[model samples]
Target: MSSADSSSSGFVLLGVEDVEDCALSNEGEGSLPLDRFGYVSDLVKKGNHAFRQSRLDMFEQAINYYTRANQIKPNDPIILGNRCATYLRISQFLKLRDSSDSEDRPLSGLDPTIHAELALKDAEKLGEIQSNTVRPFILKASALLLLEKYELARSTVISGLQVDPFSNSLQGALQHLEKMQAGNNGRRSHTKPERTDDFDCTLCLKLLYEPITTPCGHSFCRSCLFQSMDRGNKCPLCRTVLFISPRMSAVSVTLNSIIQKNFPEEYAERKAEHDGLTNFGADLMPLFVMDVVIPCQKYHLHIFEPRYRLMVRRIMEGSRRMGMVGIDPTTGSFAEFACEVEITECEPLPDGRFLIEVEGRRRFRIIRSRDQDGYRVAEVEWVRDLQLPDGSQERVDLLESTNNIAKHASSWLTRARQASQQDRSRYEKLLGLERMMPTPRDPERFSFWLATLTNRTPREKLDLLQLTNTRERISRALIYMRSGELGCRLDLNTITNAPPYTI
Candidate 1:
C-alpha cells in the first residue's frame, strides 16, 4: 500500500505475519480497523517529526510508525511519501554511523537511492505525474544524482521546470547538482581496477546491484533475494532463515561501503547494473541463429554443437534465456530481427548434448554483437508492434483488416488440410493450425504464429519474422495468402525437405 513497498505481493492475501508486520498499534495490538484515518495521519506527522529529530534511532522509529500508518490506509499519499522519506533518512543515518569501520569494514548490498526513487514512484502513482509537483522531481533527481546519472537527473529537473517554471527550489537544486557533477568529473585520480566477479550475486550470477547481506553473511542482489524470499524467507545459499522482510529490508550499507572503498570499479558496475534498462528483452542474451522462431511460440532443440552446448549451459546458469535469430541470406549475418526465448524444458543426455525446449518471450533488434565462447551474443533493445490506441480510427481499421485476413487465412489452411489429408507429412502441420490458430486480437502475435506453422523456406520465414509492425506484418501475410504463395510454400515435400535446425 505504500506505493513502493517493494515487498508488496500481488493478489495474494497477506498472512498474519504480513499483516502484523505492516500494521501495529501503540498497544502492540493488530490495530485491526481500530485506528481511524485521522489517527493514522497523526502517526505520519509524528514519523515526519521523528525523521527531523537528527538522531539515527529516531529515523528508524519514523519508518516504523510511518509503515504502521500505511498498513491502515495503504493509499494515503501523505503516509506513503513520509515512509519513503524515512527510509532515505535511515539509509543516510546508517552510512554516517558506520562511515569508517575499524574492523573487517562493513560490507553491505543496501541501496539507499532506492528509497528516493521509490518515493518518486509512489508520488507518481498518486497522479503526481500530471501535477505541477516539485517534491517528486526533487526526489527523482536526488536518486539519479546519487547514482552519478547526471544526464537523467538534468532531464528530470527540466521536466519539473516544465511543470513549474518559477520554482526557485527546483532551479537551485539543478544548479547545485550540475556544479557537483562538474567538480567530480574534473577530479583526477588513477587507481588499480577492482574485480566485479568478487561481488557477483550467485542468484542472477550477474554483478550485484542493491546488494544485501543476510544474517548468515551471504550477500546477494536485493531484487534476487526478494525473488527467493517470495518462495521462502531463507537464504538460497546457506538455508539460513531470514529474519527480515525483503521489501522492508534495506541494502547492507557496511558491505557496500567496504566494496566501494576497496573496489571502486566493481562499485561502478553495480550502479550501472541498477541503472540498466532492458528495453526489448531480458538484459542481453546469446543469439541462437541456427533457425528462425517467433515470439509466443515454442521450439524443441537438440544441442550438439559445442558452442551451443556452452550457450545452453550459460543460459541455464544465468537467465535461462537467449535470443533466437536466423541467418540473413542477404547480409550473411544474424537477422536484424530476433525473438527472445526462455528455456522451459532442459534434459541432459549421457553425452554432452542437451535436449531442450524454449518458449519465445519478446522481439528485439540487435544493437551490437560479440563472440563469447565461440557463440554469437549481443546487446538488444526490446521491439514491439506499432499498436494504435483502443477505439481510435487506425486501431479499428487494423482490427477490421486483421479479422478479414484471419478469415482468408483460415480458409487457406482448411483447403490445405483437405487437399493434404492423404499426405500425412503435410497434413500433420495443417491439422494443428486450425485448432490452435491465435485470434486476430494481437495481429503481430497471430501473424507470427501463422508464419511459424507454415512450411516456408528459411528466406520466407526471415521475411515474416523481420516485419516488426503489427499491421504491416498482418498485411504482408495477407498478401502472401492471397497470391497463393503460402499455398505453394506449404508443400509436404517442402516441409519435410527444409533444413533441420537445432535452435
Candidate 2:
C-alpha cells in the first residue's frame, strides 16, 4: 500500500462528539452535571478547530475549556488525556516557529520553557492517575525527547511498548532509535584500529570540526579534505569516487518530537527569544543598507563568485552596514527575519576574490523584497529591546564560561603564533583575537558558541538559532556543550585508538 493509505489505516481518530458520548454515559453516575459535559464537548471542538487553523489564541481558549471540564469531571482520564495532547501540540507548533525565527534578536519576557515544563508535569500527573493510558505516556515521552533527554525518552517508550507490544507508533520510534545508535557505532568502528595516539584524527583526527563524510564512508574535517579534493574527487583512504554535492543526513523526526515534549520549557523560551531577534525588521520599508548573512560560526568567508562579488561591491559602495538574512538550505528562501551586520573586516584577494568578516548587531524582519541592479534588496523593521526572564543570572554565567573558554583558546593560539615567528598582518592578529571573543550583547552568539563547543550537528545548531530567550538559549547551550565535551572525551580512546588522559 502507498504511504498515505498506510498512514490513514494505522490510526483511529477520536472526535469531540465521541468524547462527549463517553462523558454523557458517565453522567448517569451523577458524578458530573449534564451541562458540564456539553460544555467540555464544545470546548474540545473549539480547541480542535483552533489547532487545525493554527490559531494560538483559540488554543488558549480551548485550554480554558479543558480546565473547566476537568473541574466538572475531576480525575476523568479522557478529559485529562486529551487536554495533555492539545497542550503538547500547541507547545510543539510554537517551538517550531520560534526556532525558525530566533536568529533575529536576544529573547526576553515570558518563560516558554517553564510553561512547557509545567504542562509536562500536568501530563505526568494525569498519567499517574490513568496509569494504563498509552497517550499520556507517549506525550510524556515526547516532552522528554524535546528536552534532549534521549535516555529518558528511550526508557519511557520501552515501558509503554511493554504495556502494548503491538503499538506501531512505539515500534516505529524504537526503530528510529536503533538507526541512530547504529550510525553512531558505525562511525566508531570504522576508525583505524592501531593509530593508538590521542589527539590524532580518528579519521585523521587532528581536532575534528566541520566534519564531512566521503562516499566511501571515511570522514574528515573540512580543512583536511579541501586540499585533497582539489586534486581529485576520490576518497583518500578507499579511493571510492566521490559526489561533490553536499548532502545533509536526515534527522529522526520521532526523536525530535520527544525532545520537544520533554523540554517544553527550554524549547519554548528559546523559540520566543529567537523570534524576537529575527523578526525585528519585518515591518520596515526602503532598506537602503546592504546586508550579509553568514552561517559558519568560524572562518573568514571568501567571496569569489561573480554574483556575490558584485553584490558585495554594491553594498560597500552604498552603505557599510548591511542586513544579513540566513537562508534555509532546504527551502533556499531567506529566513522570516534577518540581522543587521556591520562590516568589520574586508580585503581584496589576488584572484579578484574578497575576504570579509561581519559582526551581528540587531535583528530585523523583511517586509518585502525587490531586485536592484542584479542584486536582492529587502525592506525591514528593526526589533525593539529584548527583556530577560527573572533570575537569568545563571544564564549569564554560562555565557561568561563560554567566553572564558574562548579566551583561553585564543591565548594558546597567541603563544603558538609567537613561537612560530611567522609574520602576521595587523588584521590577521585582530581577527585571531576576535575569534575568542563572544558577541557580548547577542544571545544568538551564545547559542552558536554552544553548538560549536558541543560538536552538535548543523541541524541542531539551526534549532539553537531558532530559540527566543537568552537564558534558555544559554542554558540549552551549556547543557549541550558540557554533554558533548563529556561524550567526545569519553569516546576519545575508541575514536583515536589511544589510551585516555585528562584534558
Candidate 3:
C-alpha cells in the first residue's frame, strides 16, 4: 500500500507512549472512543507487551488483530511482517519452554513448523517490498533445526550467509547447527550400531532418494541404479543382469518415503547435490540421432528406436527442438556441422514409436557432443554465413557465380535422373524423387539440395553438409556438376547411406 493510502486510512500511527497511554486510558475510562485503526494498533501493542511477558494468549491476540487489520488494508506488508515476526517468536518461545522439561510433550494442531513456514513466506513478501534482511532467514533456519531438518537448516543459513556474509547472528547459527551435526556424527562414529535393514544405496552410500527395486528385488537409488546400469545393465549389488534406462525408472514409493521420513537430512542434502550434477550444462541441446539437414528445409522422421523416442519426447517438452548431425558411419560419431530441427507434427503409435514431421530451423556447429543417458547431446554455437552488404562488388560477383553454378548443377541432376526416367534406376523409390526436385530459392539451399540429390557416400555428403560458406558450397557443387566426378545419384530400389533421406 502507498504511504498516502495508508495515512488516509484513519488508522492511528503507533508509538511506545501511545501503548503506555492506552493501558492507562483503559484503567480509568470505561471504554476509549477509538477508531478502527487505533483499535487494531492497540491490540498489536498489547500483543507486543504480552510477548515481553512470554504469554502465548497475547501472541494469538496479536495475530487476530493483524488479521483483522489485513482485511481492512489487505496490501499492507507491515501488518503481514508484524504477524510473521509474532509467529516466529511464539514458535521459538514455545520450543524453548518445551525443551527445558524432562518429559516429551505433544502439542496438538499447533505445529510450529507450519507457523515458521508462514513467517518465511511473509518475510519473502517483505523482501519483495523492501530488502531481504538476516532476521527472517535466522527465524526460519532455527525453526527447521527445531523440527530436526538439519540439512535444510544448514542450506537456509548458507543462503542468508551469502546475502550478508558479515552477519554475526547468521554465523553463530551456522556454527551451532554445525556443532549439532558434528555431535551426531561423533556419536554415530563411536557406536557400531546394528543395521536396521536400511536400504541405503551401495553406490552413493546414502539413503536412496528415489529407490528403484531391481528385477532381482534389490533396491537402489534411481539415479545410481541408472548410472550403474548405463555402465553395464547389471544389478549393482546382486550382479544380476537387468534391462534399465534413464527417463524410465520403476520407483519404489513406499521405500522412498520410508527413507525420507527416517533420514530427512541426508535425503535433502543428497537430492540438492544430485540435482546440481543432473542440471550441469542444462543450456545445451538434445542431439537428434539422424543425418545432416540444411537450414530452412522440411524434413520428416519416423522415430522408432527406443533411445530416439525418448530424445524426441525430451526435445518436444523443451523448445520442440533438437540438433541433428550425421553419424560419420566410419567414426560412429556425429559430424562437427549440425542443424537444429523443430518438431512440426507428431503421431504416437500404440507400440510407443512415433512418426514426426520436423523442419530445419537453422545451422549450428557442434562445440562438443557427449552421451547423456543413452542418447547424444551437444553444446553448439549457431552458424551464420558472413554478412556481405548488397550492391557490393564482391557480393554481386558472388551472387553471379552462385547463379551460374546453380544452373549447371540443375542440368547435371536432370541428366543424371535419366536412369530413373528409363525405369532402370528407382530413384523415385529411394527419396520419393520421381524426377529432379525444383531448385530452392536461395543459393545456399540450392547447394544442399544438389548435394542431397548427388550420389555420394554418407561421408562425402557430410563433407558438403559441413561447408559453412554459402559461396563455397555453390562452388563445390558446380565443380562436381561440370566435372561429372561423383555426381548426385540415387538407387531407387535399394536403400543407400547418404544425405537427404534420413532413417
Candidate 4:
C-alpha cells in the first residue's frame, strides 16, 4: 500500500498487538514469563511503526523487526501477513520509482523482482498456516501481480472469492488481472511491422539467433560473433578491440525476446539453420583435425582454440561425436582417412576451454569436406576391413595369425613391463593398453589393438587406416611388435654391457 492510500479503504494493516499480548498473558499463567511477552510485543509494535513511515529504508527496517518477532513467536499468522505486505510495498515502490528524479541520488538494495519473490514465499507460507483466511489469498494475489504472473494472480483471487464471496479486495484484484490480460492480447493482435534489418545480425546477414550485444553497442549471433573473434579479438564492424570471450559473454535477453515475440516464424527458421550446422546429419560429420586415432584407443583432449571450443559446445549438445584426423604431410590438408570418436566426458572450464575424453569408435573416409564457421565438416562413408569368406581357408589362416600375434603381444608386454620399471609414463601406457586387448576372433579389431602396442608415426598410422585386408594389417602389426621387442632387448643389453638378446 502506498503512503497516499494510508487514508483510504484500499490500505489495510491488521492490529494484532493487543491480541498477542492477551494470548501471551494467558500462556504466562501456565509457564511463560511476562517479560517474554513484553519483548515480543515491543518488536511487533516497532515493525508496525516503521512500516507506516514513507521511506524505502523504513520498509527494510520493518521487515527486520518483523523477522525478529517471528523468531520469538514462530508461525505467528500476524507477523507473516505483515511482512508479506511490507515486501510487496517495497517492491512496488522500487519498480515505480522515477528514474529521472533519482539521477543524482542512486538507491542501493535488492532489486524489485527479488523482493516480489520473497513476498510470494511469505504469502505462500501464510496461506498454509491460515488456509481459511481471505488475507493470505489477497497478499498472494498482489505479490503475483507485481511479479507479472497474471494467470496465477487471477487464480489466487478466485480462490479468495470462494472463501469470502463478498470480499471487495478480491473482486478488485480479479478485475485488474482481466484488464491486464486484455491489454496484452490486444497489443499482440496489432499488425506486425514490415521485416527489416534491425533484427538481423550484421555478421551473418540473417535473423539473429542467441543474439549477443557487444559493449560497443553492436549485436550479432553468438556463434557468428565468436567465430569472427577467432580471427581477431576485435569487433567486426567497429574494429574495436574486445577482450570478451564466449565464456565471459551473455546473450542480449531483451533484444532476443523482442525478436522472438515479433517475428516468431523467422526466429524459428534461424534456430533450425543454426541447429543444422551443429547437428549436421547422420551421414555428415564434423572433423577435429588433430591426430591419427584408431578404433578402441581412448585419450583426452584440451580444447582452447576459439573455433574448437565452439565446436565442442555444439558436439556436446548433439551427438557428442566427431571425426579425429591428422593433416596429410603430402597435401597439407586433412588426411583422406579419419577415425570417428565419441566424447565420453566433457568439462567446460570457466575460461571457456573444454577438457574432454574421447574414445575412437570406427573409421571413415572423407568423401568430401568443407568449412562451416571455422571448423571442417565432411560427408563421410564408413570404412571397414573386407571380410574373408566364412569357413574359407583364408579365414582359417587369418585366425591362426591373429592368435599367434596375440601370444606374442602378451609376452612382449610382460618383458616391456619389467624393462620399463624406471619409466613411469611408459609403464602406465603399457598397462592401460594391455587392459584393452581385443579377442583374436575379430581379426580386424585385434589388428588395430595390436598396432597400438608399438609407437608409430602419423604416416605409418595413416597407412594402417588405408589397409582393407585383415591378414596384411595383422602381419604389419606383428612386425611392429617384434621390432619393439627387439629394441627393448637391445637397450637392456647395451645398459648391462652384454650381448644383444634375440626376440
Model 3 agreement with the true structure over 254-283: per-residue lDDT tens digits: 566556666677779988876544343434
* Estimated TM-score for each candidate: 0.40, 0.32, 0.37, 0.52
In candidate 3, where is summed lDDT lowest over 10 consecutive residues? 9-18
lDDT of model number 3: 0.55
Tens digits of lDDT, candidate 2, 410-483:
56445544554454343234333334345644445544443344355434444544555655555554555444
**lDDT of every predicted structure (CA atoms):** 0.59, 0.48, 0.55, 0.72
**Model 2: runs farther than 4 Å from truth?**
1-30, 98-112, 184-503
Better of 1 and 3 by TM-score: 1
Shift in Å, residue 208, candidate 2: 22
User: Which 10-residue window in model 2 sums to the lowest lDDT?
Assistant: 3-12
TM-score of 4: 0.52
Model 1 lDDT per residue over 308-388, tens place: 765665565456788888888888977888888887555444234567778777778889998865787798888776767
Clashes of each: 13, 46, 5, 0
Clashes of 1: 13
Candidate 2 achieves a global lDDT of 0.48
Q: Please give the distance, in angstroms, between residue 375's alpha carbon in candidate 3 and its true position after superposition.
A: 1.7
